[model samples]
Every structure is written in C-alpha cells, then in structure tokens.
Target: MYFLSKELYFPPVDEASFEGVLAIGGDLSIDRLLLAYRNGIFPWFDEDDPILWWSPPERMVVVPSIYKVSKSMRNLLNQNKFSVTFNQNFREVILGCQQIERPGQNGTWLSDDFVASYTKLHEMGIAKSVEVWQNDELVGGLYGIDLGHIFCGESMFSKVPNASKIAFVTLIKYLKEHNYKLLDCQVHNDHLEKLGAIEISRETFMKVLKSEEINFSSSIQQHGR
Candidate 1:
C-alpha cells in the first residue's frame, strides 16, 4: 500500500492491492477528499487505524431509474407515516449513523475526527444528509458525499422499523426525479441488494464519475426546492 502526505494525492486505483487497499495515512482534508472521490477512492478504516484508502475491484451502485422498492415498502410509503427532509439536521443524522450498531462490525468507523471532517464537507455543500422524522422525533437518516451526479453514501441508521429504508427511499425518489446519474454505495450488502443496488466493475464506476453529470444547478434543487 501507498502512504499519503500533505501533498494531497493518492496513487491510481489500478495500483491497489489485491484486497483493494490503495494507500494509507492521508489526512481527510477537503481537498484530499475531493481528489479521492474524483478518482473512485474513499477512506474506510477502523477508529483505531490510520486513515486507509481503498478503490474496490467491484463497486456497488444504485441507479435511480432502476432502484427497487418492495411491495411492503410501497405500502409503507402510501401510509404516509414518516416525514422526510434533506439537510434539515445533518449533524444529528450523522451522529445516529455513528452510534447505531450493525451486525458483523465490532465498532464504528466514524470516529470523532471523521465526524468533524465530514461536517466541514457538509458546510461546504459537498456532503448531504437525509433525515427521517416520526412524530417530531428523528428516527432514521443517512449521509454521504455528493460529487454532483453521484452521491457517495457513507452511512445510515434507523431507530425504528424501516426508518432508514424510508429515508433512503425518499432520497431515491428525489434522485430519480432530478435525474441523478448514480448513487455510489461504495460497497455492497444484502440490504442494498434488496433495494436494487448492484455491483459494477470499478472501471465502470470511474467512468460514471468522470462524466460529471451532476453540477451546481442540479444540486441546488435538492436543497428543499
């Protein structure tokens, strides 16, 4: 693996190890984060480890036009039981993601420093959160990097049944309406697969990023318009 520095660069994704670890030790500066996303690389390390960068051999992605919502999910949507909003309470959303436990994981990767850095990105309008509220309580949410056309999802959490799913489904509808090119889930899981996210070759993912299909005007509409 490669080591990073203050210079703000990561080696090509093609040079990554067989396990897809590309580099290590890079600070999560805004510039580095932008550069990393542009190159199809992202940071994913345990709180105890130095920042590790990766470009997976196969990328997990969701296309808004093709995303699937189950019959039960559709029924839930029709019930209008939850309210969804964007950027309404970003800090709370991310905090939920950091604290909510998941199976097969010992601890959260969202350390305090990671939260601070990502909150900065949110302030700069490059990161986004989807909040799901029920009876005036924040029940579920998700947050991610918005590289214009592609939203690189970081994490999501649900405190109630289908709360996180509600938040995600809302986001998917918005993206589909607004013509977002892709939702970059970064990695795959059975949960995402159930929602119609699929694995594509890294080369395909990189090509989509290079297309720059999302831009400022496209993003502004997402800000409560």
Candidate 2:
C-alpha cells in the first residue's frame, strides 16, 4: 500500500496487490477521481475509514444487449406498472441507495463525502442516474460514471420489488438506443450475475477503457432533451 500525495504520481498498481489495497487515504479531488476511473480504479470506503482505492483482479461487467431478463422480470417489464426516467432527482437516487441496506454490507458505503464527490462529477456530466417511479413516488434508481462507450454502474436501490431491475433495464435500453457497447458493473455477486454481469480480466477491462474516449456532454444533452 502507498500513501498517495498530491505531488506523487499514482503508482502502477499490480493486480496481485489489489487484495492488499494499493493506496489509502487521499482527497477526492477531481484530478485524482478522474485519474482513478481512467485507470479502472475507484474509491470505496466507509465514513470512519480513509479513502481506499480498489481495482479488483477480476472485473465484473455486462454487455448491455445480452443482459438476462428472467421470465418473471420479463413479465414485470411487459406489465409496465412502473415508470422510468433518466437523470431525474439524482440526489434523491443517491440518498435512496444510501438508506437501503444490502444483505452483506454492514452499512451504507455512500457516505456524505461519497455523495458530495459524485454529485460534483454529476455536475461535470461524467456521472449520471436512472430513476424508477411508481405513481409519482420515487421507488428505485442507480447512479454511475459514463466512460466513453462504457457505463460504470456504481450503486442502485429498490424501494419496491423489481424497481431496481426496471431502472437497470431502462438504462440499458437507452444505452442500446444510443449505441453504448458495455456496462461495467464493477464487482461480481449473485444479483449482478442473474442480471447478466460476467467477470473479465482486469487487463482486458483497462484495455477497453483506454481505447475509448467518451463524450458525456452529448449523452447528457440527448438524455435531457
């Protein structure tokens, strides 16, 4: 592990050391944040902990077009009971995700600092959100960074059953409509796998990220209009 300083260039973190944590305790400046994402790294730490950057050895991702929609999920989609929208109430989406508790997580990782940093990114048009609604009520949604042809999904939460799924499906539909090629889910778990997320090598993931130059401004314009 290394102490990242404002002047020190980030080291080339080896995949083997990701388990040990490559860097710890750094301010979430725009430069640092952008550099991390560009290198396929991200910050994930609790409020009580210092900033911990991670780049897991095996990257989990999903190809937008091939996401698995189970029979039940398909039925729910067909029913159209829930309404979906984009970039609507982004703060609300982040707050909703923070309030919900995941099965294994001790508590919310979306701390105040995390929210503030990502909110700044959102303002810069690099981070975006997808929202799901039920009769004027906010039920579920997700937020992530747009890196070129890739959408690096961060977090999502559901107030009602299938709400998150709806948000995810809607976002992917929009991605496909706009010609996105990949949706990076970040890490693997049963939930993501069921939704068609698969594991890829970190090298491959970085290679793809390096090859693309995303224009988030255009996507934001298209989405808002």
Candidate 3:
C-alpha cells in the first residue's frame, strides 16, 4: 500500500496485487482525477471516508461491436418508445444515479463531493452522459469519463424497468457509430455479463489502454460540432 502525496506519481500498480490496494487519500482535483483515469484507476468510497482509489485485478469491459442485445431488448428497440440523447441533462442523470439504492448497500457512494468533481469534469468536456427519456421525462441514464476511444463508465440508474438497459444499449450504438473501441465497465456484475461484458486480466486491459490512440480534446470538439 502506498500513501498518495501531491508530488508522488502513482506507484506501479500490479494486477496480481489488486487486493493490496496501491494508494489511498487524495483530493479529487482535476489534475489527480485526470491522471487516475489515464492510468485505469478510479475513486470509490463512502461519503465520510477518505478517497479510496482502486484498480481491480479483473477488468470488466464491453466492446461496442460485440454487446449482446436480448430478444426482449430487440423488441424494445423496434418500438422506439423511448428516446436517447447524449450530454442532454448531465446533472439530472447524475442525481438520479446517486439516488438509486443498490441491493444490500445502505447508501450511495456518489457523495456531494463526487458529484461536484464529476460535474467539473463534464464542464471540461471529458465526462459525458447518455440520457434515456420516455415521452418528456428523464427515466434512466449513465455517465462516464471519455478517454479518447474508451469510455470508462462510472454509474447508471433506472427509475423504470429496462430503462437503464435502454440507456446502455443506446450508448453502445452511439459508440459504435462514433468509432469507440471499448466501454470499460470497471467491475464485474451478473447483469453486465448478460450484456456481454467480460472480465479480462488487468494487464491485458492496461495494454489496450496504452496502445489505443486517442485525441480527447479533438473528440470533445467534434462532439460539440
């Protein structure tokens, strides 16, 4: 374990020692947050707790071209009853996600500080959101940091059944259209696995991250255009 300081570069993170926890304690300042995303690390901790950075041993990810859409989902897509949009209402989406109660979890980890930090990232054009709407009401959505061709998803929520799934599918479709290679799910979950997310060794994930060519600022500008 290493203690983070303003001057120290994040130590060499080992896949085998993921449970060892590389570093702890740091402000989610723009510089540190940017560095963390570039190196496949992210903050996840309770509100009263110090910032805990983690890079799990097995990275869960979905390649846009290969995501699985079930028969029911296909029908939903055909109906087109719900609409999807990008960066439409980021604040609403984040608040919705934060309010959702996860099974077995007593409270949300999406603290006020977390919201403010990510909102700042969104302003910088690095964090993007996908919103799912039915008629005119925002129902479900997801948000993440856009690292060139990779989207490191943070969290998602659904107020109605299949709403989150709709947002996720729409996100993949948009990524496919725009040439994104990978959607980093970050951790494993049975629900995500059903949508074709798979666990790969952290080393493999890091290799992909290193080799992928990305121009973040240009991508943001293009999206704005």
Candidate 4:
C-alpha cells in the first residue's frame, strides 16, 4: 500500500493491489481530485479511516449510446410524472445520496469533507447533478464529476421506486445530445448492470482516459477554472 503526501501526485494505476487500492492519505483538494479522475483513480474511504485511492482492475462504465431503458421505464418517461433537470440543487441531490441507505453497506462514504470538496467542484462547474422532481418536490437525483467527454458518476438516490432509474436515463439522454463518450460507474452493481454498465480491464479504461483523441482542455475552459 502506497502512502500519499501533500504533493498532488498519484502512483501508476498498475501499482494497485489485486483489490484495487492504489494509495492512501491524500487530502481531497480540488486539484488532486481532478488529477485523480484524469488518471482513472478515485477516493473511497470511511469517515474515520484515512482516504483510500483506487484504480480497480475492472472498471464498470456505461457507454451512453447503449444505455438500457426497460419498457416500464420507457412508459414512465412517456408519462412524464417526474421532471428532470441538470446542475440544479446539487447540494440537495448529494445530500439525498448521502442519506439514502444501501444494501450491504453499514454506512455511507459521503462524509462532511467529501461533501465540501465536491460542492466546491460543483461551484467551479466541474461537478454536476441530475434532479428528479415530482409535483415540485425533490424525489430522485444523481451527482458526479463531468470531465468534458466523460462523466464520473459518484452517487444517486431515489425516494420512490425507479426514481433513480428515471434520473439516470435522463442523464444518458443529455449525455448523448452533448456527445459525451462515457459514464464512469467505478464498480459493478446489479442496478448499474441493468442500465448497461459493463466491466472492462483497467488497461482498456486507461487507454480511453489517456487517449489523445479526448481533450479536456476545452471542457475546463467551458466550465471555467
């Protein structure tokens, strides 16, 4: 296990252990987080534990063009019972994610520091959120980092059945319209698998992440520093 210092640097992703832990103890500064995502790494640690960075052997990602929308979900979309919006109430959306319970997890990793850091990212327009509204009430939503050509999804929540699904599909539509190339789900879960997220080797993931064909400079400029 590698330990991180105040310096804004990360070990090569190939250095990660079989379990995908690459490094530990780095501060969650905006610059560090940006660099981490650019290099196919992310932080995931409990509240009392030192920050842990990971570059998993297998990454779960969604290609926007192939995102699955079930027939029932399609009907729900057609019904228009829920309204979806982007970058609206990001704090609320993240808070919702923080509070929602998940199976097998005793608690959430969205600690206060994590929230503050990502909120700053949102202020800079690098982090974004999808809000689902029903009768003007906030119901379901998701939030993540937007790296121009790709979206690094962090978390989501739904107060009603399939509400988060609705938010996710809506995000896919928006990504498709904007020509976004990928949605980084980080790891696998039944929920994401049903939505077309697939596992790919870390090498394959890094190839896309470091590809010369993808340019993040424009995205940074568009979103502002």
Residue 168 lDDT (model 3): 89
Per-residue CA lDDT of candidate 2, range 1-225, in tens? 778777634666573274636688778887788888877788878878888888887778766655556788789999989998888788999999888978877888788878898899999999899999999999999999998688989999999888999888778878777777678887778898778667766666766687754333343244342
| lDDT of each residue in 46-144, candidate 1, tens digit only | 999999999998778777876678898999999999999999899999999999989898989999988998999999999999999999999999999
**In model 2, what lDDT does residue 147 have?**
81
Query: Which 10 successive residues of model 1 have the least lDDT summed?
Result: 216-225
| TM-score, cand. 4 vs. native | 0.91
Worst 10 residues of 2 by lDDT: 216-225
Give the alpha carbon lDDT tens digit for every residue of 103-197 in model 3: 88988889988899999999999999999999899999999999987899999999888888998888888888887778999888899988767
**Shift of residue 180 alpha carbon in model 1, Å:** 0.9
Question: For residues 48-84, what per-residue lDDT tens digits would candidate 4 score against the true structure?
Answer: 8999999999888776765566788799899989989
Is candidate 2 or 3 superior in TM-score?
Answer: 3
lDDT for residue 17 in candidate 2, whole number 0-100: 77
Error of 2 at 86 (Å): 0.5
Cα deviation of 182 in candidate 4 (Å)? 0.5
Any runs in candidate 1 off by more than 4 Å, and if so which? 212-225
Ranking by lDDT: 4, 1, 3, 2
For all candidates in order, the CA lDDT equals: 0.86, 0.79, 0.82, 0.87
What is the alpha-carbon lDDT of model 1 when measured against the actual structure? 0.86
Collision count of model 1: 1
Off by over 4 Å in 2: 15-20, 212-225
Instruction: For each of the candidates, give the backbone clash count.
Output: 1, 1, 0, 0
